[model samples]
Target: MTDIKTPKTWRSPAVDIYETEAGLTLIAELPGVERDALDLAFDRGTLTLEGRSDDIGYQRRFRIPEHLDAEEIAAELKDGLLTVTLPRAAGARARKIEVTVH
Candidate 1:
């Protein structure tokens, strides 16, 4: 497991996190945040989001789940909402096995 440390600029925001069969989804209300101003980064099993909305600064850190494939993560900003999708790691993906008995 990677040790995740929140940055000093991190701020708790009103957001919702949900997990689905495909991946993990994060929805954050970032009113007045422009697409170009928002930044998303993932490193060492830590996901960070930072941006400036109307001169107000905001930062947040999320502990990336062990099952999540940080390299495949994607984020989008639209209608003042930031949506992040994190795909599961290879070892974490569901697999099927068959057994034969004689």
Candidate 2:
């Protein structure tokens, strides 16, 4: 009798998203993936990431917040990790206003 207790494989890529006062950050783990193999696209309010590593391929899509500035999207790949930064839109940036004393 063979013991079949191995964990099931997952088909989706591993990713993490974080939101801060200044912007939103996305991190993805892509082992064996070359920098040139990665592809990123943003349309409307959606951000998509697709890539292939070794024999594995991955695709992920995220719904970006309206407060985020899609024009300032930036990405970096280092140590098998991809980091993307999306700055908040102009209206989302924090501001201070003074009230006139009566």
Candidate 3:
């Protein structure tokens, strides 16, 4: 008799997104996932997160807008919680300008 093994399934982590005047904040719950096992990437205006632990796998993806500065994106992981901050591009920030008559 031959034994068959099944491939592990990826689970989507719980995510929360909030919009502020300066930028967007994303929080994800990735229990049991360690920093060394986590992979974060930004490509073609899309943000991807992947992680794996001994018992579970976590994955999430979000489409990033052009107004957000991908180069300035930052992420932090602690206590099984991951926080990603996407700051708005300089051209995207709202600024007030005084109008002058010629």
lDDT string, candidate 2, 24-95, tens digits: 899999776677777789998899887776456767899998888889999998998999999999898988
CA lDDT, candidate 1, residue 32 = 71
Whichever of 2 and 3 has more lDDT, that candidate is 3
User: Candidate 3 lDDT, tens digit per residue, 36-84?
Assistant: 8888999998899988876577888899999999999999999999999
Q: What value of lDDT does candidate 1 attain over all alpha carbons?
A: 0.78
What Cα-based lDDT does every candidate model obtain? 0.78, 0.81, 0.88
**Preferred candidate (TM-score higher): 1 or 3:** 3
Could you give the candidate ranking by TM-score, starting with the highest? 3, 2, 1
lDDT of 1 by residue, 3-83 (tens): 223334445556899988788999988877777777788888788887765546577888987888877888888988899
| Per-model C-alpha RMSD | 6.8, 8.4, 5.6
Error of 3 at 54 (Å): 1.4
> Looking at candidate 1, what is the lDDT of residue 44?
86
My TM-score estimates for the predictions, one after another, are 0.80, 0.83, 0.86
